[model samples]
Target: MPEPDEICGVNIAFAVVGSKWKPTILWVLAGRPHRFAELRRAVGGISEKVLAAQLRELERDGVVCREAGAGFPLNVRYSLTPAGVTLDRLLEPLAEWGHQLQRGR
Candidate 1:
């Protein structure tokens, strides 16, 4: 069931992961958990401010999880939530499609 404002499942999904960096972020996180710095490096070309903002958004949407280790340095790690893992799996076809498109061009 969907609300009137939602329109459809596609729109709902896009609303959650439609940003330029969101898919790439999810793709990187799919490999394994990463610290903030590691994620920033893995998802290159994105500014710190943008990465932070996108991560926060993903976390808020329940697609990502942030865990803080108990230590003086306060290590923080980011990983895909169950929902995010499912989303990442769903994106595989899209990724393959993109590769095909790139090869065609």
Candidate 2:
């Protein structure tokens, strides 16, 4: 049901974070933890449904941590896990490369 190329390490990594929104979500989480609404605003242009879905997938992949505060309003915060921090570090060079390309360098 999957292509041979999809079984490799690189592909496996991509499978976890291959979506357009995942990287942006991770980028925001990399800074600090954010409540669900705060995260939605920070990630801008992504629908609530999509953000919810992405966060769920990231949580399932062990890249994001969702903690619910014990309060009446139900404050839910999202942050990156250790593995996510490492992944974010790896993405830094790639982001730099993207910037370079954008600047026509």
Candidate 3:
């Protein structure tokens, strides 16, 4: 697989978080670890299949971590990894910029 660092930082960042639902996913998870259903609710319009696919992609990119518990009824939770935390920090300024742009518009 091609490594993200091999490319420009902006390209890699976009590759990881540029999808319609991904930045929202990262924003939600930045607050705290959440269960799948909770994330579904928090993210608003994303379907189960799409959410799962996005989460899988994020996990593959090492930006998100999934924890599974063993039992008759399994419990799973997702949280941001260190890299994800760094991305979240970066997103803060971008989000502010969006807000300022909207105000200007």
| CA shift of 22, model 3, Å | 0.8
Model 2 agreement with the true structure over 1-105: per-residue lDDT tens digits: 656775686786888899999999999999999999999999999999999999999999999999998988888899999999999898889889999999995
Judge candidate 2 against the unseen true structure and give its global Cα lDDT, from 0 to 1.
0.92
- Give per-residue CA lDDT, model 1, range 49-102, as digits (tens): 999999999999999999999997999999999999999999999889989999
Better of 2 and 3 by TM-score: 3
The 0-to-1 C-alpha lDDT of every candidate, in the order given, reads 0.95, 0.92, 0.95
Give the poorly placed runs of model 3, Cα more than 4 Å off.
Answer: 1-7
Q: Assess the local accuracy of residue 105 in candidate 1 as a C-alpha lDDT between 0 and 100.
A: 100
Counting clashing residue pairs in each candidate, in order, gives 0, 0, 0
The 10-residue segment with the lowest total lDDT in model 1: 1-10
Model 2 misplaced stretches (Cα beyond 4 Å): 1-7
Question: Which candidate model has the greater lDDT, 1 or 2?
Answer: 1
Ordered list by TM-score, greatest first: 3, 1, 2
Q: Which is the winner by TM-score between candidate 1 and candidate 3? A: 3
